[model samples]
Structures are given as C-alpha cells and as structure tokens.
Target: MVIQEQIRIQTRGRNTYNITGEVSEAIGRAGIETGICQLFIQHTSASLILCENADPSVRTDLERIMSRLVPDGDPIFDHTLEGPDDMPAHVRSILTHMDLSLPISQGRPALGTWQGIYLWEHRTHPHQRNVTLTL
Candidate 1:
C-alpha cells in the first residue's frame, strides 16, 4: 500500500522546527504496520534533518556552525535577488538534505529515542514550507 500526505509548516525565520510528532501522527493515520516512510520538503531554502532531540544546544551549535560555513551576503555569491540570505540558504539546503527516509514499524516512525525530525529553514525571513510524506 502507498499513502501520501502533505503538511504545511510555518517557520519564524532561520531556525529548526521539530515536526517529529506531526510525521508520527501522519504515519499512524496511514496505518502502515511496516514500510518505508519518505519525507520530502518542497522548497529550496529549507531542508530536513534527524538530529539529537535531548538537548536544544545541539541545534544551536549547528546553526552557529552553518552560519560560519555559509555566511549570508558573501560577496562570492551573486544570487542575492531576494536578500543576503538568499544564496546562502540554497547552499545550506544543498549541503544538508531535501528528503529523508525512515523505517515505519508498529504504525509509527522508528526513530531513535533521542532523535527528532526537523525542518531547517535557512532563510532569514518567515515563510510557509510544505513537506510531503509517502508511506
């Protein structure tokens, strides 16, 4: 069986929004006892990740490191039509992942105890993002 669903996420700005529960709920609704759950974000400036959920510091550190590696308004990039964060956002998304695949078992996503799924918005301004889930 194949089940597909799309969820809209409103991001405040450049931050990580945890959507683990949402995904799990979707999986439960699908009622797939065992299968592969695929999540795809339909935006270039945003991506997805499975990261440590026990501490918020991990995400903070990731933001700090990503900012340093791909600073906004870098003179090297010429795709600044939107803003300083425009080009960097695309780069960050490329470096990360636009899609994720997780194993579903017992009608839920088989994520680790300390792992959570997040939508990483690389843009500096708020925007609406969409994530498509296929199970």
Candidate 2:
C-alpha cells in the first residue's frame, strides 16, 4: 500500500519537537497494511530524526551537542544571508537528516516504545514547518 499525507507544525524555535504521535496518527489514517512509511521534511533549515522519547534531557543534550559541534558564526561560513544561524542550520542538517523511512506493520508505524520522531528546528526563530508522509 502507498499513502501520502502532509502535516504543518508550528515551532517555538531552535529545538527538537517530538512528532512521533503525529506521524503514527497519519499512518493509521492512511490504512497501509504493510510497508515502509517515509517521512520527508520540506525544509533545509530543519531535520528529522528518531530520538529517545523517554527523557526530555536527552533532547536537551542533543541540542547542546549539536550547537557546540556546529556553533553559529563560524569565520569560514559564507551563507549568513539569514543570520548566524543560517550556516549553522545547514551544518546541523548535514550532521542529521532530512528524510526517514519507517517500517509499517498492521496499519501502524513500527517504532520502539521509547523511540520518537522529532523535527530538529535549526532556525533561530519560530516558524511553520511541513512534514510529508509517504507509505
């Protein structure tokens, strides 16, 4: 079975927002008996990842590590058209991912109990983001 769905999310900015529930709900609605559900983030300034949902601190640490690894305002970056976060955003996206394919079984996404989907907001300000689901 093949399924297509789109979801818009409003971010507070610069953080990972858990979106597992939304993706799972969309998959359920699609009624795909068995397949792989692919998730694509329609933006370069953001990323997609499966993260530990059991603890909020894990997300926090991830953000901190990413920030340190690709801190804003590096002297070598030339794509600062948006701001310091612009180049940093690209770097973060490079380190992470923009699309993910998940196993779907029994009309549900096969996710571990403690694993969750996240939209890693790389921008420095709040904005609306698009999530496309394809199964």
Candidate 3:
C-alpha cells in the first residue's frame, strides 16, 4: 500500500526546523510497519535534510559555513528580484536536497539516535513551506 500526505511548515527565517516528530506521526497514521518514507519539499528556496540533532551547535556551524560558501547579496548572481537572499537561497537549496528517503521500521522512521529531519529554510523571511510525505 502507498500513502501520501502534505505537511505544512512555517519557518522563521533562515534556520533549520525539526520535523522528525511530525514525520513520524504521519508514518504512524499511515499504519505502515515496514516501508520507505519519502519526503519532498515543494519549494525552490527551501530544502530538507537529515542531520545531527544532538547538539544545536551543529546547525549553527552549518549556517556559518553555508553563509561563507554562499553569502547573500553576492554581485555574481542576477536573480535578486526577491532581494539579496533570492539567488543565494536557491543555490543553497540546490547544494542541499529537495527531497529525502528514509526507511520505515516498526511504524516509525528508522533514524539514528542523533539524527532528525529538518526543513532548511534558506530565505531570510518567514514563509509557509509544504512537504509531501509518501509511504
């Protein structure tokens, strides 16, 4: 059997928002004991990731490194219609991932002890993001 659900996430600017519990809840509702859970973010400037959730500093360091690698307002980009963060956000999403696939075991996402799912908002302002979950 296959099940699909769309999860709405509101992000508060450029940061990673954990969605592990939400995803697991959806999986539980699906009643699928063993299957593959696929998540897809339906946005260009945002993405998804499975990262270390044990420490908050990991995410902070990631932001620091990404800012250095793709600084906002870079003069090289020509798609600044949405402001300085426009093109950079798209680049960051491209560098990360627009989708993720995880194994579902015993009616839950089989994530490592320190692993959690996150919605990486590359934009600098708050916005509503949509993630489609398939099982």
Segments of candidate 2 deviating more than 4 angstroms: none
Which model scores highest in lDDT?
A: 3
Error of 1 at 88 (Å): 0.1
**What lDDT score goes with residue 125 in model 1?**
93
What tens digits encode model 1's per-residue C-alpha lDDT throughout 1-135?
788999999999999999999999999888899999999999999999999999999999999999999999999999999999999999999999999999998888898999999999999899999999999
- lDDT, candidate 3, 34-110, per-residue tens: 99999999999999999999999999999999999999999999999989999999999999999999999999999
How well does candidate 1 score on lDDT at residue 38?
Answer: 99
Candidate 2 TM-score to native? 0.95
For 49-114, candidate 2 gives per-residue lDDT tens digits of: 999999999999998899789989988899999999999998899789999999988878888988
Ranking of models by TM-score:
3, 1, 2
Worst 10 residues of 3 by lDDT: 1-10
Mark the 10 consecutive residues where model 2 has the least summed lDDT: 1-10
